[model samples]
Target chain A: MMNPISRVAKSLVLLFMFFTLHATAQKITPYLQTTSQVLELPSRVLNETRTIYIHYPKADSTNPNKTYPVLYLMDGESHFEMLSQYTDYLSRWDVNVIPQMIIVGIVNTKRTRDLTPTESIINYFGQPDTSRVSWMKPSGGNERFLQFIREELKPYVDSHYKTQPYNILAGHSFGGLASVYCLLTHPEMFQAYIAVSPSFWWDREYILKLADQKLKKGGSLNKTLFFSDASEGVSDSSTFHTNLLKFDAMLKAKTVIGLRFEYNYYPKETHMTEPMPAFYDALRFIYKAPYK
Target chain B: MMNPISRVAKSLVLLFMFFTLHATAQKITPYLQTTSQVLELPSRVLNETRTIYIHYPKADSTNPNKTYPVLYLMDGESHFEMLSQYTDYLSRWDVNVIPQMIIVGIVNTKRTRDLTPTESIINYFGQPDTSRVSWMKPSGGNERFLQFIREELKPYVDSHYKTQPYNILAGHSFGGLASVYCLLTHPEMFQAYIAVSPSFWWDREYILKLADQKLKKGGSLNKTLFFSDASEGVSDSSTFHTNLLKFDAMLKAKTVIGLRFEYNYYPKETHMTEPMPAFYDALRFIYKAPYK
Candidate 1:
């Protein structure tokens, strides 16, 4: 038998030969043509700098003037890639379930500060957290956040990219709350809204009350909204599920004209995992073709 | 009143101001630290160059020698980004459902040639196509394809990356059929297998017969296998769903020792949409903690 060092040397020679062969024949390219860019923009309304991820469809040289709709996503750090992958797959010529659109993922600096619509220190269990460094301390700057989107981010994106006037705002949990809040206050900002497991428990369901007031019976709210809740507080009789039901009932009672809405309850999934399926369903609903 | 040219000029001025302010305050960073690189390796077995997308977890300074399990994904061009997004999200510290694993997505040159096991030119309806340019022609290269993976790709990955012995092979559709075939014939190759919407009707249930023959009754076949079928033939009787049921029943009858298996039926989903949820379920099943 050969010595240990000689055997190792023989293996190295074989490995080198294999690599040499690969090097001669192999050619590699980037797997995805779709590109995402991270840009930090100064938010004059919020008095801060915000980082946003902008993912655009691969350019079509054949159609130079081709413009696409835009989707403004909250909780960019958590769900940007998921939506990007979904939109890319669904919009493929073979899978053509939805049209290709631009995605603007807004990364968070202070989650509670930017996403919450009102200033309150109330915790999830309806208890007030009096701690100095509580996450709820810097609560309620969503109005300014919306202003930043409408004035600064939107203008920049619209000016730089080929985009249609139609837009969709999507979010989850606190972001979901923000989506609902936006729909209630500035319904014209987006043509469609998707709220995945919105935290209706926030500030004693402040947004729910707001929705009750703003959405009058037979109001002309011409927009599509898709909201959902998962297994959160499922063990209890009344919780997020009930809150969603209340909201749904309110919408039904109000009979807002042209306000196309869908409510999905995923009893098996958690708040985190619900977004994977909910977002897909939301897209399909938003892009569902008109009947023959 | 301003004319069109004057309005355009004013808009340009405002845009310039916005850009100047952004340039002063903006900062940009790459969004996804978990970067994937595309590499092409020449396959001596198939006499062709194969492209593979390699996605790795971000480097952890805390544990420089940290290793990960490997997931070999077929139909790379179709589902690479989705799995990459899933693995990254699920393995996050906050959402610690599954451990982070390196994903090697093998892109197709000749898809049917590499994925199908047998050389028959049978269509989806079990009819033989005698056409010269049939996609089914130049088939039955799966064994050689497996040889390329086992001999060329896995060795390259093992040598290069910090990897654990635990590995998984995942595929969908034809790729899914390939995953099942691999699990049945070459059990030692992967510790786990995931087949999402596998095409069981391939060559009139070739793999089903193989599985029945190879998996002996009460034999020691230590592995984890998760197979699923969606709403294919839901409008009719006895199709992919029935095929899955037959496979599941065979497993039950044989009672293979050390084999952990689960079958999921997604009637609400289609062949394409099934992977989005099935993959998530598969990961959860694979990493489920023991019951109390």
Candidate 2:
């Protein structure tokens, strides 16, 4: 054999060539074969341009004109890929726990403005002439935001894609708050709602009060809802867990006709980590349907 | 003003152009900004070509040269993206539940042949598989498969990726069988093991028998393991659930030195759906250590 130094150099050259061939020659494709699209939506209601991520079911040869129920998810930037992956996997032919549905992920512009129900400077701890230059100011433009969805986004999505009339609204934290607010103010919007760790303490429980006022006892409101909390505020004042329990109890007491709801508490998970499992379970619960 | 029909036509035209711009002018990036690479690895040990998908942690400007723990996942084609997404999401600055892990997904070729341990044609219901061209004919080549992993795959990964000394092995179903086999036969290959609903029923419980015979009364097989099962066999003969219980009990009784293990039972989930939660829980369990 030749000297060790040259041998090492020669081996490196061969390895480099091998990787070069592997990189360029191989038919490298994305791990997830996604036909997902990013759409730019201009809104007159909010007077701004918004970007939304849309994930549609892979074209099925079996169901050529198959229309899908749409799940409108919030905080698209953080969890769009996640929800896309979950929906794709769970609805696979082999693992058919849930139905194949379209996902419209609404990316954030002014999160605090759009998600909250009231323009209050109040903070999470129940007191605030808050911190100077707090990002939580200019809150609560939910009505105008929903108008954008109702008048513009929904029509656009329905016109562009193959969509069923059935709709599901899903979100976490502030987005969750928006989902609850939508249910109270505009119950006709979605057939199902998933509010994972909703910020229910917003503006002295405005949505909670709205729910109590709007949800008539034994009323004919047909809906499926899944709300959950993970280790948030269970230790101290228990505001988060307590708020969820209060809402659950309120729903039970009302016993609204055709309304189905479930509440799950995750003791181990945190706020940020809860969405993955919560959303999956929500889909499972929502689609457990001889849906109307 | 335009008539209703013309208005509709004009709206459609505008919508088309809007989508065209959204498609063309806008920088529409893939949801998950991935630096993942697909490598075609030719293995001498098994005499087959293997495709491995590698998901690295995104470039950290702060720690540009940082090495990472690698998780070798079987059933690469099925769960690679899930694991990749999980690792990415969990290791995010906001949702810091687990350490960032490099996932090396080994795509299956002859899945049944490679994953099974004993070369027997026995079926799950404790009968000799007598069907014409039973898929279980080429039952066992796990030793050689592990050899391929140890000799070819691991070295390739260590050399190619910015990998730490620590490694984790994860799998489900038959893939789970391979994971347990790797633990028993080649514990040094990985620091942690995840076997989600392992097929202990393989070859009249070959893995269980091996666990019985090989595991000393008080052995020093220091390793971290998380194994779980979902809604399986608990209704009748309970072979699947019982097998897991037996293995769990055996481990506890043996009390192997430095062996930290946990068994989880998910009664609500099915075998096909268990991997999503199990793998997430497994990572949580394994990396709960200030790892050795």
Candidate 3:
């Protein structure tokens, strides 16, 4: 029912459409996918089955024999994913500076109990809140918490996976306090430590005094340490920055051998927001020199 | 055949050994397993089939409807894993600012051809290389390359997966030049554009000239742009810093509306090393003011 010229035009349009469809059918290749699992751990100290989160790089045909370093993070429930992603990207085979590492996020059952080093009735503002809902009621159980890690957790991870002995202990706030605590008490447990906005005023700077006592004059302590503080507002006319400064000075005076350390102050960043840039800087500083 | 006391002591040692083995076994847990896959893409424009590496987060049993934003990265074979890990970590439900985004890495087929705009014989030294092994032999195929993305690649991605319209385009070096090229030619293609150490030295700074021409005076251009440069040594009495400064001036003079722009220069970082920190800074700058 159509003329030759009209039919010719129609066929040309159909041909163009067909080629377009074929071109559009080309598929895009994805670069990365991740999976997260909830791991249950029985903590004899807490007398409860605590759920810890573990994030690791997935294995592919191209990299089946790859083994990863481990970063045991505190406050795992809060910032586990942040550290997981940071390690994954920084150590990517292509990015390749820091080695691909496994992230073992230790979720907190009772933050006050596990992160604090000593029992104290004082709060952040030096005021005692003896209320039933007091956040500091169950404080000072870090020694037992560290025991949970040394006795129960580390063995579990080592036996279950292909892990390198190089380990890093990292945390923020109370978790940050715990990171420094672990470094001071159990230095041999980890190769590196990261403490972001550590609660240095805990039990009137208990960890500060401990560091002074444990780090003997002219003694050798070979380890890497990264600590940072953000703009934490003053409560009771006492600034958090002052405490951090004092702690920084204490560590500097010790001058422990092979102690690769960096202290960063983020004025524009808040306590909660400091992790974004702090973690990135930490990784860069930790792996500044290439791993041979 | 031994004496009673000696036999009893041997039996006690064996019992102790059995308890130790049983205790160690109780402490260790099984390793968590994950999987990965590789994807391939064939392009007629470059006459090559490129391999794209992929890593997907393992699906969580608790949350299944978590759709991710897609980051279409240039120079996939170079920095794909870095970006992948950054996004994954920053978007973990705890440290969420930007949503968890899927990374679509476009591996280069013809590096020089697809990334450049004009077919020129100009080398980095501002002289023509007329030799057979010239790196710029088949230069200037960005138009067709972008066509492949618009008609062929994007459609394929949209059809194959769950993608939000909010997309980001990122690149470094020559790939950085391509990022700006796409921004000028196809303004609406991506929500954000990241160019780390863009080669403004390309084609006598053709992209800079094009930016001046296309960006109309007092016009609204709603886009987030993060560009940066690193120290590339002072050569021929000229430094890489001067080039970046010029580009920064051009953007400031235009003063395009709704265009959020941040420029960073790393004096200590090298061209190859800048991407690590620059990319991290860019992400922070892009998401500085989070959506409530």
| Model 2 ranges off by over 4 Å | A1-32, A130-132, A236-238, A289-292, B1-33, B235-238, B289-292
lDDT of 3 by residue, A132-237 (tens): 7777878999988998888878887887667888888889999889999999999999999999999987877778889889987667889888999887844235
Window of ten residues with lowest summed lDDT in model 1 chain A: A25-34
Residue pairs that clash (backbone atoms under 3 angstroms), model 2: none
Off by over 4 Å in 1: A1-33, A235-238, A289-292, B1-33, B235-238, B290-292
Best by TM-score: 2
lDDT of each candidate versus the true structure: 0.87, 0.87, 0.77
Instruction: Give the alpha carbon lDDT tens digit for every residue of B165-272 in model 2.
Output: 989999999989999998998899999999999999898889999988888888798899999999887754648998999999999999899989999999988898
Chain B TM-score by candidate, in order shown? 0.88, 0.88, 0.84
The sequence of per-residue lDDT tens digits that candidate 1 reaches over residues B119-167 is: 8888877789999899788888788889899998999899879999999
Task: Output the number of the DockQ-best candidate.
Answer: 1
Tell me which of candidates 1 and 3 scores higher on lDDT: 1
Error of 2 at B119 (Å): 0.4
- lDDT of residue B128 for candidate 3: 71
RMSD of 1: 7.8
Better of 1 and 3 by DockQ: 1
lDDT of 3 by residue, B23-102 (tens): 55443243332222455656665465555554455565687865555677888877776676666666666556556667
**Candidate closest to the true structure, highest lDDT:** 1
Give each model's clash number: 0, 0, 12
What is the alpha-carbon lDDT for the whole of candidate 3? 0.77
Which clashing pairs does model 1 show?
none
Q: After aligning candidate 1 to the native by TM-score, how far in Å is the CA of B96 from where it should be?
A: 1.3
What is the Cα-based TM-score of model 2? 0.90
